[model samples]
Target: MTVSRRAGLLSAFLLPSVLTATTATGAALAQEGKPREVVSTISSGYFDDYLMLAVDGKAKTLSGYYNDGKCRFIFRDALSPTELYQRSELGEAYVVDSWDPDHPDRHFTTTLYSKTPNGYRNQLTLEPGSRDENRPKACRNRISLDRSSWVSESFYDVAVVRKRGARVFTIARAGEKPTPAPRKDRLPPPGTGVWIDRTYSAAFSPKGFVRLNWYDPPGTPHGGYVRQEDLYPSQPLPQRDGGDEAVQ
Candidate 1:
């Protein structure tokens, strides 16, 4: 998108009613206390000017909402209602580049803390670009999907194993049988590869499967899963100064 066009779009999005709560009461209502139970309902949107990852009809993850009213919350795993609030805090400090607003496809670099044998620790990711500038798109293909579509431009770099050993991996979609080695040229091809040095979020398995939502290469950005042994414990990344990687 052009600079001027991008600015106009951002201006429209930044308007109080669209991006945040204009009045204290609106903010207060949006920031209302968490729901009392795990009701299985999950929602996404602005609550009191803060973007939130809502659960059980309540706002669990909170932050400044942006990106054309669509904030993508990567589901790391299922947690108690209380633990959800604690993890959502990671999005509070997300600082995007001034020019990032131009590219609607980009997502903020989040600070992920994954569980490991030693305990929880921070992981690193590429810092988000400016909100006002054009940056390289995370999803190479520009195919547009609905806000609720499975396709995503960003990903959560989680691990299923640690550095203690190595294993071959066959990246497969959820419910699909694992193929030996699909092809290296494709995105997340089913292949046998060793763990790379990096840090990601904790493993979350619901329904007895390790799940993730991301942009499926050569197609839409959506959610998929792999075997538990496929992931690894990653090294931590240095924290950035400011950014709000909010949940949807």
Candidate 2:
């Protein structure tokens, strides 16, 4: 699809009210410690292309490419911890959630993952709105994978602090001054490990900054932006003496 068409489809998927409602639902699910469901949609198109879906069961993630011969888009979703128990199913199954970039607040959970003879597959029932206007009101399809694969590693870059007292900010724009990260979202002590999503790192590269997320001693995740200069490419290991030693 053309870029303009893709943008229009995404815009139509989520109205302001729908976005607010779904975003609230996602937040509630997180607060309740409930497993998150995963879903995906193509907006509008014939289901003839080679739609590939790969699952990393261990990580509870699903990722794949959607190709319609003309255009291709990549999607990945984190699956819920809860499993679906069905009488005829073998192995495990979990709920999946998917969202569009234009309407991040809106999420769908109409897809399901199941173990198959070859490996794993996802069976998805397309949402009414996601289908072409002239197509059937109900649509379903399956995408299978022969093996599980790690997808997160490809999307993030790992780094560690280069010096003590380095700071992270909540936002870092190309031309605007950055806003300091809140106390709760501050970077951990120097030499601690942190990671920045490739998407954010690349987007803010013009500003010489990268957003980083790290875990405090308690294992809680905190994130903020930091200047690229404050980080080193390698993560150092903590030595017995409380200092960090470069990895060989």
Candidate 3:
């Protein structure tokens, strides 16, 4: 697959109008005052870009990766009680509210964090069609905590030509030329899900590039590269009985 082709397929599937309903559903889910099981949170670079992995008791796990230390976190319970989730190390605290009344999802709308001047602020909002527009769609983008790594499961859309469809695509890269990876001769249909385990990099890259290991359902895994923009980085909860070191 080439960059041009991937963009074309993404654009074709992203018919705005067609995906509007799906996006709305995710926003709606973020609001419900449901109780969520604590997963894990990983923060980097002044806490601007961070990943929170949580579950709803059921198998459903939601991993949210927000850049600039700001993004809506649809949690079942408030992590703090004093109106702000404060971080003494960063000298900043976060506030929460339901800005979108119509699309309210028990989650805070826009960004609700500020650095204390205690009055200095880093005003940021997650408005519709904003910079965060490229975010992954809920349900379509699933996050999981596998052992110690925060894994993201999503499908790749292969475009169909006159008669045949594409199986491989040239993945996009950050601040560099795209790289082509080996692929299977036969590819699943456009909607077939090709799950990937997101590889993390502590090294900061504005492009949000990540290593994606392709999984054949219950089989082995393959390797690939992708940008972490739409996807969020997640930290796994503290180890259970096994007591393994979590990946950073």
| Model 2 RMSD, rounded to 1 decimal | 24.8
TM per candidate comes to: 0.21, 0.28, 0.22
lDDT of 2 by residue, 1-248 (tens): 99999999888886777989999999988887853342422111112223434444444455433433332233344533333434224333433333322233444433444454432322332221233232222223344323222223432334546667776666534456444433443456644545555443444454666766554653355666677777653212212343212111
How far does residue 176 in candidate 1 sit from its true spot (Å)? 17
Candidate 2 vs. true structure, TM-score: 0.28
For model 3, how does the per-residue alpha-carbon lDDT over 1-248 read when each residue is reduced to its tens digit? 99999999999987986689888887788866553333222211112223222222222232222322222232222222122223333332222222111132223322322333322222222222123333322311212121223333332111111112434433545455545443554333322222333323333222444444433442455545434322322223222354211111
Clashes within 3 Å, all models in order: 35, 7, 10
Taking every candidate in turn, the Cα RMSD to the unseen true structure, in Å, is 21.6, 24.8, 27.1
lDDT of 1 by residue, 1-248 (tens): 99999999988878866545558667777677644332222223222321212222121221211232332222222222222344543332222221122333433333222232221212212133323233344422111112222111122232222222223333444554443333322224322111112113333232323444323342343334434444432222324345223323
| Model 3 / residue 201 / CA error / Å | 5.3
The prediction achieving the highest TM-score against the true structure is 2
How close to the true structure is residue 214 of candidate 1, measured as C-alpha lDDT? 28
